[model samples]
Target: MAEAAAITWALELAVIEMFEHICIESDAKVYVNALAATIDDCLWKIRALISMSLKLSS
Candidate 1:
């Protein structure tokens, strides 16, 4: 679950950095839903940061 979130967050940041929209296709409905829900702040922050870094790299 954590890894999936990280990947999703990274993809989102990348899409943002590219100034393009993103449409994520995933089979993990629970994961997707949880992203919008309040849970695991530390994991979310870490994943968000990683995603931002990935976006900046490109």
Candidate 2:
């Protein structure tokens, strides 16, 4: 679970540092869907990745 979160952070860094376009593939539907949706999920690890992702995009 933490490894998944770590991957999310790594992806965030990759987006922020290098890639202009990125595609992510994963077997974990929950995490994938969570990233796609705008709903508020309060789990800290997930939220951290979400925050980093938004930061990267903005």
Candidate 3:
């Protein structure tokens, strides 16, 4: 869950910095898969973070 939050925070920072290109990698498959999963299908704990990450990445 923390990993997902960090990912979202990093994305927010990147956007604030006006970065045109960036790469994010994580070894936490749980968080990675949670982000890839649909919001409804994701665990409740990380759902909001995943949604935020999606919006930021888009």
Candidate 4:
């Protein structure tokens, strides 16, 4: 959840800054894998954050 929150926050910042491209690096392999999956497959705890991150990233 914490990792997801950090990613979400970073993505939010990138969106606010109008960045054309961004790269995210994390040591949390499990969370990274979760984020790579569809929202429906996301863990319940980080689902909302992941959704928001995906939206901001796109």
Residue-pair clashes per candidate, as listed?
0, 0, 0, 0
Off by over 4 Å in 3: none
1-58: candidate 2 lDDT, tens digit per residue? 5645765677877875887776777786666776777738635557767666556655
- Measured on C-alpha atoms, candidate 4 has an lDDT of 0.85
**Tens digits of lDDT, candidate 3, 1-58:** 7788789999999999989888989987877887777789888888888888888988
Q: Between candidates 1 and 2, name the one with more favorable lDDT.
A: 2
lDDT of 1 by residue, 1-58 (tens): 5656555566766766785655556675555555555455335545554444344434
Alpha-carbon deviation at 48 in model 2, angstroms = 2.5
Off by more than 4 A, model 2: 41-45
Which candidate, 1 or 3, would have the higher lDDT against the true structure? Answer: 3
For all predicted structures, in order, the TM-scores are 0.41, 0.59, 0.86, 0.89
lDDT of 1 at 4: 68
Clashing pairs in 2: none
Candidate 2 has a TM-score of: 0.59
Give the poorly placed runs of model 4, Cα more than 4 Å off. none
Q: Considering TM-score, which of the candidate structures 1 and 2 is the better prediction for this target? A: 2
lDDT by residue for model 4 (25-44), tens? 99988678877898899788
Model 3, CA-based lDDT: 0.86
